[model samples]
Target chain A: MGLTKSEIFSTEQNQLAQLLKALAHPARIAILQELMKSNTCICGDLVEELGLAQATISQHLKELKNAGLIQGTIEGVSVCYCINPSTWEMLEKETSGFFSSFKPAINCC
Target chain B: MGLTKSEIFSTEQNQLAQLLKALAHPARIAILQELMKSNTCICGDLVEELGLAQATISQHLKELKNAGLIQGTIEGVSVCYCINPSTWEMLEKETSGFFSSFKPAINCC
Candidate 1:
């Protein structure tokens, strides 16, 4: 909440951290996994699937949408949500780069 | 700070989220990047490299080490830090599976 000192880091590092922060919560992770498993936009099923209150699920969904990780649209009286393809691409690329770039050859105490 | 509701999520989901959370800070990401760039156990260079105070750097290092992403071993008086290969493998495997499992074929709003 205070100063993040994000300016000192490279754009890539900041972006990577932001993306990871967006996906850091267990509820969010669960929601994402459920969406992946469903393989389609979900409408009101998350509450049932997650066994959480509708309000709780909505807050989680809002966070995911705000992060651009997921997109939502209103259909009739319900909103449908699914993964945002572009952000998913960014997430995959950044994570792959971060993990792959590290070599475990450092011999330390 | 409050209850995490971890009981409702799978172990993998909880763990993946935990790992991501540990890496969700810019300072932490920067630390990891510096360590990777150095390609060896780093001792005291992080304070210089990151331009962050020693206490700040030490806290970030603690978070990473606590998550098992990095390990610190005391050498004489100073502690040496490096990536933990086993945990890195877990991180790589989990992220790989999470990203690759998506079909991306779902067409929706």
Candidate 2:
């Protein structure tokens, strides 16, 4: 029997996993940390901060944008990026919920 | 500028990213969910609960074990698995810290 991977899991499971996948890479994590450590939206500054090229940062930004984790907008000369607040909150809630879902009655270590 | 990916990022970022990678798959997420849903340590039950092949289940279990997310023990008739509580707590803390690290002053989206 052929069953699609996505078909079997609950929507919650799939969504959480997708978000995790988006954040799995070290480069992406570095990009995100740089954005967070900044007080204002970053505009072409990640390349300097992360030591990654502009093209590489843009590629990672694209993946984050696709996952709704980040958003970018064009300013006068540079494109600024920041964490999407609503999705950020959702990620927090869902991730916390997933971690808290397990209540162990007995420890079998 | 030659920069190794892991050499540039902080250890916190790298460890968190690695944990995320381990849980990034839908099958792995589902397997964890199934394990949490069960009351006691599960032994040879994931194949039935997850509707995945034994090989697939074992593979996913190995990944979880490698990440310190789950622990396994040999029972009389079967091997039992349960969540590794310490790593789980660390995951919860680190993930919460990552999400809370962003403090937005103005919406850029």
Using Cα atoms, each model's DockQ against the true complex is: 0.79, 0.70
Q: What is the TM-score of each candidate against the true structure?
A: 0.94, 0.92
Any idea what lDDT model 1 has? 0.87
Which candidate's lDDT is highest?
Answer: 1
Q: How many residue pairs clash in each candidate?
A: 0, 0
Residue pairs that clash (backbone atoms under 3 angstroms), model 2: none
Per-prediction CA RMSD (Å) = 1.5, 2.9
Model 2 misplaced regions, further than 4 Å: A1-4, B1-4, B107-109
Model 1 error, position B56 (Å): 1.2
Assess each prediction's global lDDT (C-alpha) against the native: 0.87, 0.85
lDDT (tens digit, per residue) of candidate 1 on B27-105 = 9988888888887688699999987889889989999999999988888988888888899888889888998887786
Off by over 4 Å in 1: none
Candidate 2 local lDDT, residue B70: 95
Deviation in Å, model 2, residue A75 alpha carbon? 0.8
